[model samples]
Target: MKTPLLQFTDNGIYCKKANVYLDPWKPVDHAIISHGHADHSRYGHKKYITHHRNVPIIQHRLGEINVTGKEWGETFDVNNVKFSLHPAGHILGSSQIRVEYKGEGKTSILFGYSLGKAQRLLKYLNTDIGEIYTHGAIENMTEVLRPLVDFPKTTLITRETKKEQLLGNIVLAPPSAHGSTWIRKMVPYVTASASGWMTFRGARRRRAIDKGFVLSDHCDWGGLLESIEATGADKIICTHGYTDIFSKYLREQGYDARTEATQYGEEETEAALASKSTASV
Candidate 1:
């Protein structure tokens, strides 16, 4: 039989054929990082490879590490293993690593922080629908990513924007801003929060928001199903929360699904993004 392409090692997910680790939980010799996040891309690793867009952010956090940048779809071979990077859409530079072993292929989604969700929202938005406003934190990301890629226009939500400007507007904000003082000025506006927690009715009701959008960067049930189907893999592995439940559900659907016991937390989120007034200071 052909050798396995990837396996869960003591340190993290290891690509045996490539001799590299993917988003390793501990320091390793070669780490193919997915994105720049405190937890996912931790400090200390021999060498790193990720998308070109993520290099700056990763460097900012890791500080002078050995890292190589590759544009989307760029491919390279290492020790008989072929690897390529593709946009994962969770954050800027977040990537899905595609590995080929013999004639079979598998992919790992490398997502840590999902500021990229903020990026996707701008792609499909109907600006004609209404004016778009963002909490200062979101606006800052927009400023960083706007020039790198195409995104919709958004105005920062400020004390000066005036209440009248928010009428029938769409505002992207952090979960903490849901009940904060900044939005008191926009009273009577429809309030909605985006989070994976919104999958629970209790989470939504507890927040007291008018609506909750399940706009998490991490894959949901439907998204996982779609991704798995698209991969055309005969078997599936569940790495994180609800793994057993999700795996069972997938098995019931007739696609082979199994849960992999791994120590990975839920994808980190900027759920508590604060306003510019505070972020600036």
Candidate 2:
């Protein structure tokens, strides 16, 4: 049997090959964090390796620490193990870490309390998803936060943007904009939302969205299945929501699956962004 590459302990999952822990709950010499979320990117690590764009937010939240940020595709060497950070699709620099050592490999993705949820919401949007337009509130807040974080490329739905332009686009706006007068102006377009909540057709129906994508920062059932298949990892670790059930399901499917304890979970959204209103129909 292949020796376990990463083992879960009280401190968190330890990568024996790298001599470092991933999102370690307690302080350690070297901690390779996946993102800036508080639960996943905790304080007290002697050194941290995360994505370059995440530096400011992590620094702002964690204060003084030996943190080294790297570009998404860059590889960093540690104890003969190769580590690479990739976008988690959460925030400016929220990342998923991929590690390779001695012919073995694994990765970890993090998502928790932090800003840029709005931006993460945008990455999943496209022509296939839909073209992009946003609420004045989300756009305005993005403008204010853009200097601080790298939000997804977006356009504000203003008077200048002809109504014809909105025909084939997805509007990344606040919940309040749903069925509001402003949306009436942009006819011939359907509405949708991206979240784990939409995993069920009933939820999607209740949401009344013409379409709903399971585009959660957190993985959905299908996402979990798809990720496991895509990674082809022999062993699987469940750390987030519905851990026990998912872990059991993985085990039934013939995977080395187990649940671990971690306080990290879903986070709050920007209620303040909903405060502003757009032009009326």
Cα lDDT tens digits for candidate 1, 37-100: 8777988899999888999999998899999998776777788777878767898889888776
Instruction: For candidate 2, give the lDDT of residue 230.
Output: 99
List ranges where model 1 is wrong by over 4 Å.
1-114, 194-207, 212-239, 247-281
List residue ranges in candidate 2 displaced over 4 A: 1-115, 127-131, 218-272, 277-281
The TM-score of predicted model 2 comes to 0.38
